[model samples]
Target: MTAWGVVRTAFGDHDVPSTLMGVTVLGYDGQLVEIEATAAVLDS
Candidate 1:
């Protein structure tokens, strides 16, 4: 899936967990595993 596609899926499925200032997912994996967001950073 494209980057935006992942973003959309994450947001739609509430995978983000909380309101995030930003999100960045990397690595080439067949299955979805890790999701990193800037929500905590933004809370600073």
Candidate 2:
């Protein structure tokens, strides 16, 4: 998933969250893909 990779990379740079820490819930809204990162995004 290139899109997911990009998001992961960007988040990694911003210290937001990576796949290791966050749970990505991908949802389809019509023709667009919506990504929702939960609380796991925050390293605790």
The most accurate candidate by TM-score is 1
Error of 2 at 42 (Å): 12
- The residue-by-residue lDDT of candidate 1 on 1-44, one tens digit each, is 96667788767955554443443754665557656646544453
lDDT (CA) per prediction: 0.59, 0.59
> Which portions of model 1 miss their true places by more than 4 Å?
13-37, 40-44
RMSD of each: 10.5, 8.5
Model 2, 1-44: lDDT tens digits are 77678777766756553554443653554455457856634466
Q: Could you tell me every candidate's TM-score relative to the true structure? A: 0.31, 0.26
The reply for model 2, stretches above 4 Å from the true place, is 13-44
Q: In candidate 2, where is summed lDDT lowest over 10 consecutive residues?
A: 17-26
TM-score of 2: 0.26
Residue-pair clashes per candidate: 0, 0
